[model samples]
Target: MKAFLDILKPNQLIYPNTVGYDWNQVDVNRPQGHPYYHWLQTNQGEGVVNIDNKSIILSKNDGILITPFTPHKYQSDQFWTTNFITICGYASIFFQKQLGEKKYFVLRESSCVDKDIYNLTNKLDSSCDDAQISLQTYKIFLDILHGVQQVSAEGYKSIPICWEIKNYIDDNYMEKISIKKIGRLFNISPQYIIKVFKQAFNISPYRYLTKKRISEAEKLLISNKDLLISEVANLVGFDGASHFIDVFKRVENCTPLEFRLIYYQGADFNHE
Candidate 1:
């Protein structure tokens, strides 16, 4: 009976099991921090995550694993926008159960996940029965757990660049940064920089930079509905709205308008 009562609470039961599968989008006028359980975050837009001594600029194809109750906050870093999803509560236990004990997990946002998330968001928007959504979300939660576990098991094979690259992107993505800039900053040659970084990250420096820009653009579009699409494009370094749209369509397989409609008009994704 005590356990049953625990399950009835809005905070506990709605999280973890039922919540992990859904996506939530938020925009705060100011910085906000929270104590969360297990949460996975993939940045949809241009922003930076500052937690403890670490900072990460959200880029396309980057995913983050945030441990429970680790105080964290996000900032735009520029006028750029930010977007992401967080899963908390018992659902995090799914990851813990699979991956063993790790304080946090972070994946660089990937274009691969864009479609999956879009589909999940659509399913969430369906005015289907609550029981159905609940069951479906549970399944999705398991899928997310599997994804993180796969990344974890792959070890450095997946993310070979030093974590410092992630940090550098966070602090400097908004700035005009190049491989040469990075190489100079770290006292290395451009050629050596390309070799080591690619060896470590399995991706070239240019790919990393472009991905970062696209990710930031995604966040801005979703989080700041009031902002114009052209503005979002410019904020992320695109020359114009058309260019941004073309790039986004190619990578996400949807036009900017389509993406926005799906994201905003879709159902509210609630965990649990």
Candidate 2:
């Protein structure tokens, strides 16, 4: 793996520090961690992040913000690649307040802001003085924070019915559900439900349900390592482990066990 890092001296607006990447197949670990905030954005393949003993899976266009002195480690697959920036200052204080107490945030679909971050980092790299670098880096940090906030706000502004339907599916993914059932609950025809849902979410109701179930199953598999495959299948509304494995493989390009093993390699397991 290869990385390009740049560190700058501290200033009033921000303390700009390293911005770089682990090109591929890199084991990036910080047992003691850094004193400044770190924002890591993945551009390709998958990476596993362990922060304060919590594990997270990051894929393309996903980013994570980690706070100061948090024990964290990350590793990428053969094709995994990322760009990241580390910084702190008064702006960081505001960012932290906006961030709340959470040590990390997983940002999805951040490609739109990636270019700006890259450009800002390049500008910082070319900056001739401490004051210029600090100001530019502070702007980059603010942009990142604002971009995440905008994405979050947009997520809540989807059509009411579509949001309600998605919430319903998420809440009851363990049960068998159909378009007709959803339509009946919402007092709409199944055809209308399908049409508006597709328009709103870009996928059919069934696909959304499957994705919700699979996503929940992934969380369960990661957090509760002792759960049997069949148990996970049942929990996620699949009839059996075989069907669950098939769907998981189709969507993730890896079986449930394979996915689990890749992320939780040394964890103990209870087989069934």
Candidate 3:
């Protein structure tokens, strides 16, 4: 059985929908994602949480904060207990922006999570009015955010290489890019780029760029009906139409035209 604290709307900038403690968390799966931010921590045993394409393991004291609308699911690898809180409002948007490009964080510090915090908050909830509830909630939120920022700062040097490479790719994927160019910028070798990029993100830099290009191509095909396949390919950084078609087919299991025909025209996509 699981025990949780629920507070009705507190008429404040930051309020929690629910807070749970020491709960034997059942498997949770939400594909479209929860509407409010979910900040969770492991209290006992081990578990795994998958966010989008990446999976993270939660050991004792480890925590993860999932922002709104992030596809996620979690299950116990063995026995697991956790504490969690969900918060949202205008203030939540401010915090989310503060978190930067990523919508989720696999927090590795105790400061971001406290033990049996729901019990204390539950008592506060019973006695407090809307104003007090709001204040307390905002305080906890602020503390966690501040703690996460500190943890991130301390871990910055250890992380930047992978995130830097990914950020550069994200911003410049539409241009002519090469591993050598990226290596030169980072003062690292092309081989290191291939290996570290793969280790961190589980995909080669070249394939990552290709996938990014193809993703944009899909959007263009759906939205702009006038553009030819060749135009779409060039716009997304592919050199030639044939090459784009070949890569798209290999990756998406359909030609760009077929995808456009199916998704845009509202038909099933198996090319006749």
Better of 2 and 3 by TM-score: 3
RMSD of 3: 13.7
TM agreement with the true structure for every prediction: 0.43, 0.51, 0.53
The models' CA-based lDDT, in order, is 0.53, 0.71, 0.72
Please tell me which model should have the higher lDDT, number 2 or number 3. Answer: 3
Q: What is the lDDT for 158 in model 2?
A: 60
Q: Identify the leading candidate in terms of lDDT.
A: 3
How would you encode candidate 3's per-residue C-alpha lDDT over 1-272 as one tens digit per residue?
A: 24445656533345678776777888999998888888888888888999879889988878887888889999985889987888864345446534656778776656435643664367464776644455556556656765565555553446568778878987898798999999999999999888877766556889778877876786677557799999998999898999999998887667888766653343453422
**Per-prediction backbone clash count:** 25, 0, 0
| Model 2 per-residue lDDT tens digits across residues 1-272 | 33336564433435556766444447888888878888888877888999867788888878887888888999865578887878864435435544556677678877755665666656655655655555556555656765554454465356688778878997899998988899889999999888877776656889878877876786677567799999999999998999999998776556788656644443333322
Task: Tell me the lDDT of candidate 3.
Answer: 0.72
Candidate 1 C-alpha lDDT tens digits along 123-154? 55564543333333444444554466446436
What ranking emerges by TM-score with the best candidate at the front?
3, 2, 1
Candidate 1 runs further than 4 Å off: 1-17, 20-161, 266-272
Q: Where does model 3 exceed 4 Å of error? A: 155-272
